[model samples]
Target chain A: MVHAEASTFAEGLSKKQVYEQVLGQAQALFDGQRNWVCNLANASSLLYHAYHSLPSPSNAVNWAGFYVLDPKNPKQLILGPFHGQVACQTIAIGRGVCGTAVEKKTTQLVEDVERFPGHIACDGASKSEVVVPIFQDGRVVAIIDVDCAELSGFTVEDQVALEHVAELIAKSCDF
Target chain B: MVHAEASTFAEGLSKKQVYEQVLGQAQALFDGQRNWVCNLANASSLLYHAYHSLPSPSNAVNWAGFYVLDPKNPKQLILGPFHGQVACQTIAIGRGVCGTAVEKKTTQLVEDVERFPGHIACDGASKSEVVVPIFQDGRVVAIIDVDCAELSGFTVEDQVALEHVAELIAKSCDF
Candidate 1:
């Protein structure tokens, strides 16, 4: 019987502590589950709620989700599981932040989305964004995309933490 | 360029009017997209946020998502796009509300989840649930599952409206 617990960070926990807790919970949740759809669906939910459980900027996270390589069209990414307002359905490779992550095969952590050239605005309220590539067998299989409502909303620590999450998803799920 | 507008219902709109508005928006969103993942992802977001935009019992909706028939395992429903806390990864056919909808090829409108035989408590806070089957070629392909925090939170009108939504999805997306 799979059950989902409410993702509430303990009181007075530091940001790093909160991330560590989220990472631990994610590992436990992914145990014995290799389905990409299921894993990504829960992953978005976990990240979205975890951010909201915090104060200020972190709580301003407007989106958390995944975009996977389209099976029919490898040059594009189709939206996967996500928690947010509705979003762009398909993004061609190298087109936007998500596309650039696929093109660069590395994490793109933009402090301000408006400053990024060719940034696709799916939600007008999103001010900053991060996209982490999830690799499988040396090829980018999917990307984790998070958007915040404030400028410079994510830190270097956030990039590092989410990279770890990317690696975890890469290893744990069969994309 | 695909854009996601904020799903804010106008003030004083009746529940039926809300569904009608949602259906119209969904049709417009699905106009050119055939990918099930993208459509379902947006569908869940639309339903979840639309409900939250309202007051009281409708606002109490905690989960709105899809359970797709697992291609790898034809007898089980794997988690798909969703907006909520983390959830169960899979449910066997006929085992739970979602699964039963698949097995029966009909909608399951449970006023109280606690009393449903073999109820799968993915989220303990869920008091009521409605599962509507999405059919393709006269066979069930996926299901729309919505969970509410209050007993009898869904009405017959909701069921009818969602059935129309299901038909729209069936015709619009490629499963």
Candidate 2:
């Protein structure tokens, strides 16, 4: 059973503190569940609500979700679990921020999505975005994509925190 | 490209009208995407946000999501894409409302979840629930589950509309 308490962040915590709480809660949630479908579904919910519980710009997050590498198509990503508005269904390996993260095998943190070339506008309200590739056995399995309605919504600290999350997901789930 | 406009329901539209809009937008969203992962992900988002765009009790919905039949374990339903709080990872067929939908091959509409025997509490705030089975061939492929914060949150009208949505999903995507 997933407790509502798990998704509710305590008030007055710093962004880093909130993320630390999320990581701990996520670890506990994934203790015996290795299915990517279940894990990603819960992970997106946890992150989405956690951010909303925060103050200001963090609360401006418009989308937080996953796009997994299509098993039959090695070069394409299909939408996975998410907590947001309707989104793009498929994205190629080198098209948008999500694709660029996979192609580069590194996280792409764009302070302003409009400034980024070839940015796929899934949600017009999204002003900034971050994509973190999840790898397994030296191959990318999925990418975590988060978008916010405010410019420069994410900083280096967010990238570092989310990258840790990506690493945890890569190890905790079975693609 | 998925426009944010596809998710925002117009004000003062009746519940039936809202669902009609959702079904139309969902069809447009799934026009080219046949992958269940992508379709279900977007479908849940469309339902969740559409419900919230309504007024008062109708907006009390807390969860809208899918649970797919486990490929490896045919007797179980694994969590799929959703727009809600963290949820149960797996439910054996015939257990919860979702499982019962699969077991009985019919929709389960509970006025109050607390009164349902063997009800699964994924989100504590959820008071009423509805689960509609999505079928392909002669077997259940997935189930659409929605929860609301008020008792008797759904009516016969809701079940009828959602069943239509379920049938549309059954024909539009590949599991």
Identify the candidate with maximal DockQ: 2
TM-score per model over all chains: 0.96, 0.97
For each model in turn, which proportion of the native inter-chain contacts is also found? 0.87, 0.82
Over A1-175, each residue of candidate 2 has an lDDT whose tens digit, in order, gives 7776688888889999999988998898888889898899999999999899888789999999999998778889989999988888889999989999999999999999999999998788999998999989999999999999999999898899998999999999999
- Per-prediction DockQ, in order? 0.75, 0.79
Residue pairs in steric clash, candidate 2? none
Q: What is residue B27's positional error in candidate 2, in angstroms?
A: 0.8
TM-score winner: 2
- Cα displacement (angstroms), candidate 1, residue B10, comes to 2.7
lDDT of 1 by residue, A47-68 (tens): 9988887787888999999999
Give me the runs in candidate 1 sitting further than 4 Å from their true place: none
lDDT (Cα atoms) of all candidates against the true structure: 0.89, 0.90
User: Which docking band does candidate 2 fall into?
Assistant: medium
- Model 1 clash pairs are none
